[model samples]
Target: MIILYHPRATRPRSRRLPLAVLALAAALEGKEQYEIVDGNLEDDPTARILELIARHKIELLGVSAMPGPQMVAAMETSREIRRLHPHVPICWGGYFPSIYPDAALNARYVDFVVRGQGEDTLLELLDALRGNRSLDSVKGLSYKDMFGLRHDNGERPMKGPDEFPWSPFHRLPVEKYLGPSFFGKRTAVHHASIGCPFNCSFCGVHAAYGNKEKMESPERTVAILTHLVECYGADSVQFYDMNFFLREDHARELCDRMAHLNLRWWCEARVDIMSRYSDETFAAIKRAGCAMIFFGAESGSDWVLEEMQKGITTQQTLEIARRTRQFGIIPEFSFVIGNPNDPDRDTRETLRFIRKIKRINPDSEIIIQHYTPTPQPHDAGGEMYGKIEVPFPDSPAGWAAKEWMNFTLRIDTNAPWLKRRTKKLIDNFEIVVGSRWPTVQDIRAPRWSRIFLQVLSAWRYALHFYNFPFELHLANQFISLRKPKRESL
Candidate 1:
């Protein structure tokens, strides 16, 4: 049996999550051989997919999608696969499908839609498929019957973080998968835990993992790290956890173990937690070979922070950034460009904040992201606006095919003013980079090659910036611009 996982679009280098690891775990459960064919990595033409299907006798195709264009790519790929090999069952799973299972299930190309925490559910579905049993018994799956779409009630609870399978780095061509920074150096990723405790409305973590926090035991986490270093010769291991250091004790213990291993690594942590950690603990973390840390410093405006329920004040975020630098650990701070309540004043304040931080800590790197609003199951006024709906087909096969294409556009037609202002803000903020940072010198290269690389990088950053505020603005406009005769939601 074969399980193919599609990563996001192939563009200017984006990191591929450990989908191979999850697919391996599911394959192990059913005692099936699996290979992760990244569509983005190798352009999958009709002939290529057909050749693989015939060679491996593939029984299942599982496609995963991130937001925006990737969703469309996934859907299109599923449709193509179905056209070539209709017998092979296709399953759609990921953020987009999970959020809009009903719409996804109704699509023409998807055979099954797995919502939320897919590891266990995927295994279960595969088992049933192997047995030639009815898919209705599969929990967390949406299928279509002769009548219409059939969604199984309730999602399977996510497995404990410890239960997650170890990285399948051994199976993948690690050298090919390595980032530019990993050319001669080894790189690996570890997930210390699953889910975040915070309920930031703009975040998808809460929607995907719920409000509960689940962490792997310190010993198990240490063992994983040890394996990565000893077996894989990992020079640097990136912690892929949404919030790696949520528990201070866990962070300290992991740091202690890491210190003994004497390996370089990086992790993401909340600013509030970092602020409360004792200097000794941070020192230990640095000793443990933590060379860098990324913080979600969403905004400089306190009001925006408060509105997002981020639980950290701008002052607290600044202090944490400062302290991390003081400890000699590289700090990469991320900021959101647009907020729901953002105005000209707020945008200027955020830019000023970015400038201040750059002045205070010359070593720190700032990553600015644009906001997009994804449709949640229960969003404010969502019900009145006819609940943000994706056009999912009723059949499992069709739903799987369309799963990736169903995303809310960045600008809703309903709010022209918001959309116009957002474009202006993005244009204005381009000035911030110029005013605050030294101009980047153009490197001499082949004319065609340099233009291609620059354009690619520009598009990559443009797509990465899409988040809630932008999506909401788009959705609102879409609703408002609809013909008056058309009913809402």
Candidate 2:
């Protein structure tokens, strides 16, 4: 039996760890002969799919898709697959199908949708298919019955992140990927932990991984990092965990192990974790090769934080920013504007928060974001669900680079001025960044072209976050980021 997975690629030139594909690959290890195919690594993914179909006698095909435009792309692929090989069953999984199982089933080409964590769900599904048994017993499996009735078997228990065999990264097209990360060294994305401790309503982290985190052992984490370094020539790691510092001891242990490897790394933490760290702990984080840390300071206003149930305050965010900068780590904070409670005022507060962070860090990076609602309203009754000009893109790169990415203006807001400026910047971004979607080549564009793009990005942020003139906001930004107070420790 052969199984195939095509995770929509984010960039034509870059591919990070596709954990869903990897996890499924790990499960299939030694059980069957299977090939893992990446869509992002191809010039024409459909043609590649056709080539694979012609070559392999596949028993099962699993295609992962996210919500928005990616679903369309998956639908197209499924259509093509059904046309070529009518007997092969296609199963769809990931964030899109997890919540909208019934809706996803509307696409006649999709044979099944695997909701939530897929390792166990998929394994059970493959077992059922082999025996040709009724799928009614499979948990987290959603599909339409032969009579066209919808059947959703509900969520399967998630296997711990560490349970998946060190993710057959060997099967991935790693050599084709370069550093599109913080350190700008050959980078690999890894998750030492799964799940988030907090539930910020707008976030889907809770939807993907429940509130309680399931983490790998410190020793396992080190081994994985070492494997990536030795095997993949990766010098940097992006933890990509929802919240890595939830346990200070766990973090410190990982840091000590990381220090010996001398590899630069990045991770996300909550502002509340700042209270858990002393000056020495922060210093240790730096010494351990943690070059960057991100905090989702969701909103700027105290009321907004209360509304989002973010559970962290403006004060905590400020304290963390100060400590991170003082300890010689690059602190990146993200804020959400346009929460239901006072969208205009929320944006203003977010702006203030960003400015305050700049004042604290001066030489760090920060993101001020407008809240983007999912294509389908997550809330049935909330403020008539703010609309967007276009549904989110379906491709992996779309997920990586657009509005939610802190780059383009994809979502519309109540604030008139914010909407206007956002539209302008987004239009300009399309012009400068996309000869077709921007590539790493765009990053290396001529100085004037890069400056022009920044000029556009700068004005958009200024218009939304700082009430001051765009020129003044740009000036303040330059002054704040101009000089490093100390040499890299």
Candidate 3:
């Protein structure tokens, strides 16, 4: 049995941990030999997949889809597999499918979809398939019958984080999949837990994992870290948790354990959580080789923050940024633009907030992203649900394609404006700094090339500041923009 993990794009690095976790579980169960075939790792995996299916007489294929363009690719892959190997069972599992099982099951090509945590459920399904047993008894699965009727087994209780196997990083081509930025260094990605306690309107956290946050036991987290550093020789570990600091003591214990090992790591945490952590805890995290932290400061406007249910004020965000910088941890912040309720004034305010953050930490990086209305299960009850236009398709794969295309087109259309505004804003900042610092030309680009220079500078900054490959794709769209030519149908 082969488990093919299809990435959302041509780059397979970001989804490494998820794929590793799934593969590791399959290996541990001793059910069947599992291998990860990343679609994005090489040229399209279509031909290779056909070869593998025929050579191995593969019986089961699993595709992971996130909410965007990748889902479309997954759908296309499933359809292709069904066409070539009708006897094989193809499954879809990931953030989008887990939240919207109906949308996934409704797709003609998808035989099954798994919601929430998939490790145990997936293993069970694979075992049943090997024995040719009925799938109705499988927990945490949604499947369709020959009559085209969908049957949902309903979600099982959330799995404890400790129950999950350590990621099977060793199974993948580690060096080949590492991001360009970390090419020279050995990096491992892991998650300390699943779910978020907050109920952000535009976020799918609560929908994917219930409102309750789960923390991996300190021992389990330490064991993974130990394996990465001692076994894999990982120099840096990145935590992909929704909120790394939700359980303060758990975070502190993890930090304390990490401090015993010489490993550099990074994690995402909420501004409010950072502000509330004791000085000793912050010190412990820094001592634990935490080189950087990314905060989801979605907006600088209190109104926008409230609208998003971010549960953090603008002042709180600023304070956290200052304090984080004081602790000598790289404070990477992100903000959302084109907010649904944002007028011209609100947009300007967000840009001004970026300037403020730069002033506070001259070396800090601010990632500016356009707001996207992603629908969640709970979105139906949100105030913005009906008002905000979500462009996602009904099927997981279709939605993925729409998201990728939308993001591509949006960046292409907004490139000139982004370039112009970024230059204007930077020049204005230089003027403010020039009053106090005589060597301020060092801060500003020449007026003639400021726009292009700013665009380049923003791209360079975004490589490390944002999800590199995703931003690279968005940048490519901006660089490729040309007036469209009319075509006849």
Candidate 4:
């Protein structure tokens, strides 16, 4: 038997389907026996894993992890599992391992690191484990040799979603993943594409996927979503693709196909790409029940955007904001402040740009994050951005430390370039703007609480005096104002 584990990543209420584990399970379907153990759904995933091992002749334990809190949980769980069942081979996959294979292997518990798309890599690794293939032949795999030295066997060619079987959703408790969201009473999530073509400096997409993206056929996408709606009663879906709208023709076809699903959806897109989209395509997207589009308007300063290798300009962001509003679809603009070069200037410009976005469309949602650098490979142009002198941790435990964990989440990066005063300004301004225009996506915040916050922050927001929002901070202590960056659709 094999076990696929999804380490706890978010709050239980925020947890959607474990698409990564399910994708691995799809590769194992009919050929091998495996069970999924999601830490998000279980109170004690380690104990449950031990129980499974005791009852079955387990062959391997694969853990899918991302950065931040999930990495912490994964390290702790894997360490305990190794302590109790040292013989069980443990493999790590997903964004964390893909980006930092050495750190993942540095943990004694992780025996293998599956790089890139793991569906094919995992199948090949399993074959190698069964003595049918050689470990060196397994592409997108990292394992220690007899001498205890690590070897990354290079990348595997990526395939489109159609190349693989649909996720083994039947094997999972699908109902448990359906939860309440502003979009619908029972919301589901799906990744209709693999990887992203853009190589943004602040992003780690290229680390795992390279500069490639392959989208599924609209028919295949709609069919799977239809099953979720009919069989699991999922009324809404949030596409987790890095860039959902690639081609205008593709978007038009997808929108046309999904119009009959009657499902409210949200997705991320590039502002420049969407700004170039025809009004008819926007209409189709809106008609298909697209409630919101999350755009990576990385910064307000054109110089900062260029520095980040983000091809979109601030004007394009504003144009999309105006365009999305015209189509009755909310534009959720996310900004990354505190650029390594002249962080103070970057922060001020981004904050001002966010306010400008709001002025263009009062319904626009703003998301702000501190500039947290991720390891990125040099692009085809031989350019790299967001490079810093700080040494990255060489072990999972080092990354799980409080400081690094915060860095992963982009809450407080502790980047050398960012100053305390700049951080405070960002924090205070965030509170004032967020309170002034409470997110429509936040169904949890009470009406009275929203009113109270709006009233308290009105003068501060109007005058742009966001120095010390003491009263807003105190009010937030009693009332949790959910930020768009932290919440899901």
Best by TM-score: 4
Ordering by TM-score: 4, 2, 3, 1
Best by lDDT: 4
| Regions of model 4 farther than 4 Å from truth | 377-387
User: Candidate 3, clashing residue pairs?
Assistant: 68-400, 69-400, 69-401, 71-397, 72-397
lDDT of each: 0.62, 0.65, 0.64, 0.88
Candidate 2 lDDT over 198-317, as tens digits, reads 767666667655667888888898998888888878887777778888778887887877788888877788888776687777777899888888788877799878767688889998
TM-score of each: 0.77, 0.80, 0.78, 0.97
Q: Which ten residues in a row are the worst by lDDT in model 3?
A: 480-489
Per-residue lDDT for 1-489 in model 3, tens only?
A: 666666545344343444523543444445567667676674766666777787786767878876555666777778887887888888887776876677788787888888777777777787777776678888888888889888888666776677665666666666554342221266677777776779887676677777778888988888877876686566777787878888678888888887877777777899888888888998999999887777888787888888788898888778877877889887667665555554445566776686677677764555545555556642332234327444444555554454455553333223222344543443333222222212211222243333443454454343323222343344334443211110000
Which residue runs of candidate 1 sit more than 4 Å off their true CA positions?
Answer: 11-17, 20-30, 40-48, 130-134, 182-184, 378-426, 434-489
Off by over 4 Å in 3: 8-28, 42-44, 127-134, 178-184, 378-386, 389-391, 400-404, 407-489
Error of 2 at 58 (Å): 2.0
* Candidate 1, 1-489: lDDT as tens digits: 666566545452434445533544544543667766665566653455667788887878887765555666676777788887778888888776776665566567777877766777777787787886667777677766657656564657766666766656666655554443321255566666766789765676677665677888888878876776676566667777778888788888878876787767767889888889999898989998887777888788888777777788888877876887899887767775566454455566776787677667766656655544444542323221212333323333443343322313322222222456665655445423322231121122234543433343343234433223343344324323211111100
* Per-residue accuracy of model 4 over 1-489 as CA lDDT, tens digit each: 999999988898888999999999999999999999999999999999999999998889999988878888899999998999998999999988888888888889999999879999888888899999999999999998768898878679889999999898889899999999889999999998888888688788877886788999999999999999999999999999988999999999999999999999999999889999999999999999999999989899999999988998999999998998899998888888888888999998888888898899999988888877766422212123644555678889999888887787777888778889999999888888988888888788889998998899999988989987889889888888777787641
Residue-level error in angstroms, candidate 3, position 471: 20
lDDT, residue 447, candidate 3: 39
Q: What's the lDDT for residue 89 in model 3?
A: 83
How much is the lDDT of residue 109 in candidate 1?
A: 77
- Which residue pairs does candidate 2 place in steric collision? 10-396, 10-397, 69-394, 70-394
